[model samples]
Target: MIDLESGYILRPVNPVFIYFSLFCALLLNLLPIGNYGWVPDWLIVCIIFWNIHQHRYIGVTWAFIFGLLMDVHNSDLLGLHAFSYALVAYIAIAWQKRIVALSVASQALHLLPIFLLVALFPLLMHWILSGEIIWWALTGAIQAFIEALLWPLATRILLAPQRRPIDVDHTRPL
Candidate 1:
């Protein structure tokens, strides 16, 4: 039970939570939701939250690794998602303090551009490789908006284990 007197979590954050969450996100993205104009980037949000709050455990490296995995899963060009994830991680790290200090709504506003760029990375790569513009680029804009809106919910759920209640000890039943 959490002690109200002193705020501390008895259990430390588990790597399993991180890994499992990331894996689950990958699975969710792979679900048959391709028809939706705006599927959220679940893994990216989790990665950024971890890097921002627990940089030592999760950082750009995790982003790159999982991103590559995502690319492979998506069956698109390899390293495309990896490179984009790494870029977003780098940007998130650089602005983490500022972003974290803001309210969730404000955070979305600040992060929208970053997410927009991430969502656009694939489209940009397509243009460079195929020399053809995709009308689907418009969908990326909607995706960015949805991603931003999800920031608060994702942050709360993913970071729950890390936010522990206070710890209190009593020698005799004070």
Candidate 2:
């Protein structure tokens, strides 16, 4: 019984959806696209989806937790992904209104630069930590391409069900 337009909650947040999103994001992150780096950033895609749909609640904390989990799962330098993801989550929340309102195609187009930055974050972190610029140019390009291509489809999938109205009866009392 949530109002999509106003984002007013008539009931508690759907825990099922929340946890499902989290699990899906984690799985997406774990998918073995390869160590080469052409794989799309599926977790970030999910993060953007939740951040756009549930901005008020899915802020930096969730990002931090997910980022930490990603660090552990990928066995990367701790806090690097977490820091970048937290920043991205914060940005997504800040722009949720504008983002959610845009057409899916537009959203995909907008994600181009954002995904580029996301791709760069890890590379930048590695450089800072190890002082070596990993030559991931090809992988970064491919990832950006995949992310841009998948944005519209992912947004549609996440938002389609939520767009439907749920039945409510004013005569009923909790």
Candidate 3:
């Protein structure tokens, strides 16, 4: 029987690490990659990764705040990132258990659709709001693919510590 209850034991996580990582993601997103039109949404990637690992605790609020920051940094429409990240957060939170149950690669596969949806939401919203079909918006598909490709690598790097036994002093008996 698969022991689903045997989730990894973890040490108390410092919230600072999460915030610092988000800050790093913001910095990454600010890099000059606009010429490709498929710039990775670093903050969304981080938000979704954490939402999978931390579930509801890392949900809509973080998404909204970071999205707003991203919008300001990128000088896009004000709520573009906000709406996209919030929607993605809700999806991630809703599917957290099922996705987290899978191995990292499987999780990345499942996340592909979610990432694509997130990439397209803002474009769809802009089309509706501006009353014009944004042809260039289709580039979001490439952006989604890039983000999906990144999920497993980012998950492995960030969650590696969670998968390992917490370092303990051997002299102390449990």
TM-score of each: 0.83, 0.80, 0.84
How many Å off is the CA of 165 in candidate 3?
Answer: 4.1
lDDT of 2 by residue, 22-117 (tens): 788788778877655567878888887778777656778888898899889879889978988898888878877776667777777776777777
Error of 3 at 137 (Å): 2.1
lDDT (C-alpha, whole model) for all candidates: 0.80, 0.75, 0.78
The candidate that achieves the highest lDDT relative to the unseen native structure: 1
What does candidate 1 score in Cα RMSD to the true structure?
4.4
Q: List the residue pairs that clash in candidate 3.
A: none
Ranked candidates (lDDT, high to low): 1, 3, 2
lDDT of 3 by residue, 101-141 (tens): 78777888899999888788877888889888888888888
Clashing pairs in 2: none
What TM-score number comes out for model 3?
A: 0.84
TM-score of 1: 0.83
Number of clashing residue pairs in every model?
2, 0, 0
Model 3: how far residue 27 lies from native, Å:
0.7
